[model samples]
Target: MNYYSHNIGDYAQATTHLSLVEDAIYSRLLRRYYAEEEPIADNMTQICRWVGARTEEEKEATAQILTEYFQLHEGYWRNKRADAEIAAYHVKAETAKANGKRGGRPRKEAPFSEASYGGTAGNAGSSENPPETGSQANQEPGNKNQELKETSPSPPTRASGFDASTIDLPDWLDRDEWCSWIADRRARRKPVTQEAARRQLQQLAAYLAEGHQPGAVIANSIAGGYQGLYPPRVQARPGPSASRAQRLADWTDDLRDVLASDRHPREKFMGTIDATH
Candidate 1:
């Protein structure tokens, strides 16, 4: 797999205690694992060298991280989560390839009804001067309007239509939003099919299930022009609130100084007192 999904929260949680160097080594190890699509050999010296863990402390930290997150399988260290993600990636890729070979999803055909048929029939006989030739006889004047209405260009349909029930999407996400997103993707020249959308929906659903907000995720993807869904960017710290509190504290100190100064009350109130006196 050329790429695999990563959960920022999961990664942050797992590496919360790791130092910067240790975290770098751990990230490199994970990349190697996914790129090779297999486990790393259980060789401390080689692993340390490969990950640039030159110091003894760095090597020890790397070993600790691996021991906590990976398991030795057949003399190689393997991460279960990474393996599962890679497997899922392969399955989705194969499904998409197969879908492409069979031609992308068929365009959605408009539904037919007896009422429309009756209207066409009513218009057909009302025309006193019927078309003389066989071709003209087949082409009714109202039929042209009906065909144009039926075949009016719309958003491209997926081979398999999106079914919200198949994936656990949030209640706020409706078919219109889904179709609109797909249309935007198509407009950007992305090869979006129903199957690919379904897979992305599955990923988004998983993120939502993990307690992430649906709106934030959707908005982030749209703004970033991401082809796949991902967790929202970590929120910035509450700097505004802290700054407001600091300003209030400073104002209080200034007020106390004014009241305590030896200047006249009116002068102090007018902010003309010199505290240095």
Candidate 2:
């Protein structure tokens, strides 16, 4: 598994209480888990060395994070979410390999419609059509009339360079919203090209993998008047009716833990709350 989906909302909610050191340790552990595609060894020393957790605080954070997020199996530590993602990756890989064996997807054929082409041949090449046989057709090959007609060129076309119609949007994306985004870009004098369109779709797909609604993510970019799509930021503004403690809790997950635990001294509690503000 070279890559795995990381849902920002889910991850933030789960680890919002972690310190910077804890966060770094956990990230490194998950990376090793995915790279090896196996459970972590049930050895703290090895785990600490693997993640380069040299200091006492770093080592303690590594242990704490492992205990909180992982389960101790027979002789290893296993994470349910990581295991599920690995299993899914394998299933997808096998499916793709099987599809390759079958020569990949077959292209869709256009539906037959005789009305589109029925009059084309008669209108273009038939001698029986009076419009074709009149004036120009009856003129001699080297005559002045033929020369004049041949010299008259068709009107030139003005190319817009970019074609919005060629973009093949995914089914999950709202067509109207996507069109509005394209229009917004054009109005801002920064029209989307084929390469830009592809990159945007890829970014949108990444957001989708992280459990973001396609409509909302696109709408956020449009609302912000941004040139590129971005993951929505978590707003921390509390309501006017909310208490100071509630607001602090929303701002810092560690503050919530401090406020909830009576084991900490009053001075420490006050210090934590004041530090966040």
Candidate 3:
């Protein structure tokens, strides 16, 4: 008789579960004794008792064949079950549609053409007023919006639809200064410097001397620390240097005065500033 002739379940009962480990051991036994010819089919109870005595390590070695066999067989049933589910869905959809047609409940109407404002549809332009039922885009934002449409103008031209690119951007958005301003704000950060560190210490001392509250001390210390640590790498040219003179006369006291008055002297900048100062 063929070895392993009994069903896999009988062989599996040899172990608690047909665990891969049990199958491995059984296969090994098959190969060793029945290599040349089929081995006699062992009883399930006897096989279970025999497998129970064997180490799990021995069983795992023969598990591959059993694992592959079950995987292939199991996958077939899984696919069948999935196919059954799809068929059920199709039947249910058909039944629902039939019931809807029979008017079991109020069904949602398919959009064809709706009357203007909040009223029902009729022939085109049958009513002088805009459609009250459905708006141009068929958008129903809210009850207030529906009511408003009922009271307002007829379907608007397609041009009235929202397209940001078609919109007129605010004057500030088109200006280079606006972009530069944002860039400056983003550029504001801590300064990496020794002098700034010293100033930070000095500010802390001043705050303590002034007997300021802990919060104020922390706030001022942070600000002073940044100012001391980060020195502006680009120094302002004294009185606009020479090149500036070519474009707008010499850097006279008048120009220097203007620059200083307007904060070109070094007041205008980004970062943590002493607003109180």
Best by TM-score: 1
Q: In model 2, which runs have C-alpha deviations exceeding 4 angstroms?
A: 106-277
Model 2: per-residue lDDT, tens digit, 149-259? 666565556445766545555555678887888888888877887557756766666666556666787777777667777656676666667686775676575443344
What lDDT would candidate 2 get against the real structure? 0.71
Deviation from native of the Cα of residue 219 in model 2, angstroms = 37
For every candidate, C-alpha RMSD to the true structure in Å: 16.6, 17.7, 29.9
Q: After superposition, how far is residue 154 of candidate 1 from its true place, in Å?
A: 17
What range of 10 consecutive residues in model 3 has the weakest lDDT sum? 74-83
The number of the candidate with the highest lDDT is 2
Candidate 1 structure quality by residue, lDDT tens digits, 154-211? 8765345443333333334565556556666667767565566557765655555465
lDDT of 3 by residue, 117-229 (tens): 33465455565655556474355446656675566655544332222222222221232422332233235643223222223333333333233332443433234332221
Which of the predicted structures, 1 or 3, would earn the higher lDDT when compared with the native?
1
Candidate 1 — what's its lDDT? Answer: 0.66
TM-scores of the models, in the order given: 0.42, 0.40, 0.14
* CA error at residue 126 for candidate 1, angstroms: 33
Clashing pairs in 2: none
The residue pairs in collision within model 1 are: 105-159
